[model samples]
Target: MDSGQGCVGLSGRRNRCRVTDSASVAVSGRPREAWIDVAKGVAITLVVLYHAVMYLDGVGLAGAMAPLNPLLDTFRMPLFFFMSGILAATAIRLPYWQLFRKRMSLLLYLYAVWVAAQTLFLLALPPISPDGPNASWTNLVTLFIRPSSNLWFIYALPIFLTVAWLTRRWNPLIPVAVTGVLAVLFGSQILHTDTPWDKMGRYLVFFLAAIWLGPRVRRMVPHIRWWHMAVVCGVYLGIVLIMVKLSLTRVPFVLLFVSILAVLVGVSVAVVVARAPGFDFLRVLGTQTLPIYLVHTFPMTALAAVLMATGVSLPTVAATALPVLLCSFAIMFALAAYRRLAAVPGIFTVPVASWVDTSAVAQRAEQAEASA
Candidate 1:
């Protein structure tokens, strides 16, 4: 999503905050709005939890965990996409070359690096899929067409950024309508694929909407009343109950509506949590989400394997909770060591100085001054 930049408060009416720090401000570098980090913190935590449950269930480690809460599956990724969209507003104003290099190129680098890393891990470990493809250069090419397994999130960002840039100058409604159509197409599976593009079609609209709304949303978040949350929860439960009662297959349109509602609900929940004081842990967790997201897969898979090997079985709640907690702590220690080594946290961000257009910056500065 957005790099480690300063963010305005998501509560109360405030001018958008200026972002000047080059390093990530999400966790520690410089102080910034607490709520943005909190929201991100909350979203990333849910993501880890979601993955934990899924992994445990896959391996039959969850003894009593009951199947994943159907409700959580509805909104987990949407929360992330929505937050990324909010952060994307900043990019629409950047010069095109800067936009491509700073925003788009970074995602490409991360996706490529991690895709290779994942392939190596999979090949060496050789999970249940004994017939999985061998690690080779050809798998790199497949990244452009395939989802790259767990790293699909990284693969999708460049596509979102590029499209957002092209439509930066258009009437906001134009992109809104276009992305909306894309969302419906994705929901209907009319544009179905096993790749991240399948998700891109679903989430691109939220990203574009954040850019269109921009600072307006910061003020709106505080206005989410208790009744709003109540309504959101009510609707979600009603839908789930009705679906169960009917025993009908999930329709595309129904999924689309629920997803949209779930996103709104997630935003509301984040705002509520943000307004509450004394939760610095979430902000810290938020800052490290990138690194954690990258490194966590290892621990999750390893933990599952270890349990399976030891013949240790945990109840569903313990199965899911243990992995999430352990993975989070494991990633944190790994990150701490990495930082101590003075490593550039490429997992969070990487600059592409080679893509610099030195003259372009000068020309833009002069043009702005001349206009002024």
Candidate 2:
């Protein structure tokens, strides 16, 4: 959900590595990687676009964006998580409790706060669209149990990071093997699980793959020449077309392979735009993805409500146009909220007092760490 790095350097940690303000960076004094931010920019745009399509559908404006839903679905979230894993790969090696205290605490806090915020927004405005985030207040009770909200990604973050941390001590290949199996099971429809859980299972391998391969990918993204992008793009397009023609994307094992390739193709795209001049806006959007992720839906929901009330039917081309429009509006609105409220202690960040004791908690944490 965020482009900011996770956790921090700890003296007694598993790997004395530092996660930084940049998504992935040269804390040893290298410039912040623009490619990472660019990739996230691409991902977050797709994310907002997807949401806009869903929210607008009930109002009879499923627009040109509707057709892209399946193609983009393959790698959107997976790319997002892979980028996250790249940034947090170092932090994932922190001793379990330290990792929990720093990364999990913040993720959990943000998750809880945003869940409540979404509930309040829906309660006051009451979305008119049936396909909106959540319809019933009863769904609130299952926030943790079933994760019946748009913010399920936030909920899944802490859980996924924990899994990564828990397996940090094991042979790296082991967790990937296990998660790969789970992804195949859920992805191929062999496992009939509920929505969020099913998605969580399906994406677990991508994150771990990032953790395992992040450094190499980061190293490789810079040297990626235009011809490389052309080659991969051709291959990706061919494979996708073949899949669509034969419906091999739905085949059992092929689904996972195609999804993996989709993520790579996504990475390949950043190579073209990353270092190119005039793409700084995309980089900015990437850095600010956390705010956008948390708050973008507010504006989309309002769009849904407005469309429903006005009896205005958007043009079919709006599917292509509406999502970009919504993405622009939503990103601005969220960024404004983030900046204006950032100074207020408890708004943009988790209020330390809410979860941590300033007095004795550190001592207790030390003791707990030592004993455990």
Candidate 3:
């Protein structure tokens, strides 16, 4: 989910309550909106499910789950970044030093820490199903050039944050237009790059749109009608299937249009689920997305090793259901491990007082304020 890593915050859903920009109530020590968490929950689940299916299939544990990968590939991360943008509006208003200390610093820290952990894991206990350079140390030296891990979500966040902050004073349309064009260009694979960087470029526009829209979206979410959901999601689903079948998704800006449509569909889905019962688990799941996103694959590695060592062969039905089971276990295991390690500093967030040269940014912010 590296989703804004499932929001990297936790919250349970409310009973069809519409969110307003003024609703700044705290949930579990963090200011949160339940619907946002629910949305993140939805996105992160897809993320984990995709990984579970792939990890299992890699070692011959599953194969039938492959269809889901393409089906959900468009919306999940965009939904994640969109939700992050909504939450980041206030954060982006912070002075640069404060922004670095509060947001950017931790993102970089987690990326570095987890990259090292993943590299060590790959080296020490090689996957019976090797995942190539992304999961191994082979890509460490080049991390500056391109992120090579699933943790690229973490690697990309600070960059998005930095750009949003730097251009905060510009006309919102300027950054939105620039990034929107960049999204189309990069997403089309015309300037094909590394997977993570490609994703970084493609998804930046969604985050920026979310930031620019800000509270206006909160006001609109509650007022969203069922017809709104039906028409938008229906068209989105239809277009995606057609584009995917025709292999036209990369036909110059088709992906960008589909992705934007998907974000709209995501908003509709969030509004629908936020009011419904039997989906409260998703709201709760959203909060722990970060730790789970960061470490869920680690558990996958262990499970794969165990399955490989035991030579267990799952049947078709079991293989079909492995992703659901694996997704659940990964979430629970990640939450449990996170709880166990809660007392440790610097595990989930950056260590306090670690200088990363943010003071210069603070000085500039102070100057801007004084000059203003």
Candidate 4:
């Protein structure tokens, strides 16, 4: 089936679509695109860096990297969700039952396992930041009602996939418009609540937009010009300056503008790096991002504990730099060890049947051979 064609409707009223075509599949078992991996690599790295800096600053082990954290925040999570949304569009063409059993089930499983692991980990240790949100045994209930913590990204995925499937046949703009309104309402504080639903609302627009414009974006990224990059940078700097000067940085719309620009800038940089040859290590991180994300918290907390125990002192820059290096290396090493258990379900990886369409994959391989 074409990307734009799918069965969409409310619960119990949905139809299923046939999968006849696939995007970015190759005859070889290797991936057909590198930019996706590159984008993920850069985003996940930013996540590690942000966590490292924040933890260090919080514990008085390092000076605050406040300005730096805000700059990274503008795009770090957005890139992740945007990439996820692009990938989710592929499965929206699947039969409803298949989508649920494979895509949704897998994400839900990962979220459940990791949330439990994270909660237990927290209980075992002194809290990283005295002011950090407490994860009690009671917080486990939030698993069903909302996300418990950083595992929220995986939890949110099932929700986005379900929504994508239900609205598969509607004008893509319908959900986009609705979600956009909700984002504005929640983000503007007009609709007040403390729930992950508000976050889901804000991110849903990017998710749906990815489904709607993914192919077009894939086509456009390769052709992004020097001048285009220059213009984006110029505009972003100009707006950032205005916000800083006016002290309007906390204004919701100002944040929204920065977020949009940040996505563009981040994507542009990732595309450029993806086209280069030196960042293969980052590509590996991207390939194994699931494991790395789940396990990184341990290393982050450990580093903080070590600093507190040793009472070691360092220059402000060294405090920030050292934690990033040590934590990143530790997480990478831990993930390498965890790779052995990846075959086991609810371990490091989720247990689920393969979600890719076998027949469509075969067709793509045949076409690849023909073109070869």
Which numbered prediction scores highest in TM-score against the true structure? 2
Q: Candidate 2: TM-score?
A: 0.86
Candidate 1 lDDT over residue span 53-125, tens digit each: 5566656765444354455655767667766776666655677676665455656676678788867775665
Rank the candidate models, highest lDDT first: 3, 2, 4, 1
Order of the predicted models by TM-score, top scorer first:
2, 3, 4, 1
Q: Model 2, clash count?
A: 3
| Residue lDDT tens for model 2, 1-372 | 641133221221222222213323343445456777788888988888788887776677877667666766776888888887776676665566755665566556666777777777777775556555445575567678877458777678778888888888888899999998888888778886666888888888988888889878877876888888888778877887777778775467676787788788878888688878888788778777776888899988877787777888756776568777877898899888877765565455555543422224433332332221
The CA lDDT of each predicted structure is: 0.60, 0.70, 0.71, 0.62
Give TM per candidate.
Answer: 0.79, 0.86, 0.85, 0.82
Per-residue alpha-carbon lDDT of candidate 4 for residues 295-360, written as tens digits (9 for 90 to 100): 677777766766665666888777657656855785676576565665454464333334322244
lDDT of predicted model 1:
0.60
- The alpha-carbon deviation from the true structure for residue 95 of candidate 1, after best TM-score superposition, in angstroms, is 2.5
What C-alpha lDDT, on a 0 to 100 scale, does residue 349 get in candidate 4?
33
Better by lDDT, candidate 4 or 1 = 4
Candidate 1's TM-score reads: 0.79
lDDT (tens digit, per residue) of candidate 3 on 1-372:
332221122111221101112122353344555677688889888888888888888778765786757777789888889887876666677767767654566567777888888777866764457554325455677775779547888778888888889999999999999998998888778878766888888899988898888578778887888889899988998998898889886787888888888888888887888778888888777766777777888888778877776778978888888878998899888888877774465666445544332344543432332221
lDDT score at residue 110, model 2, on the 0-100 scale: 68
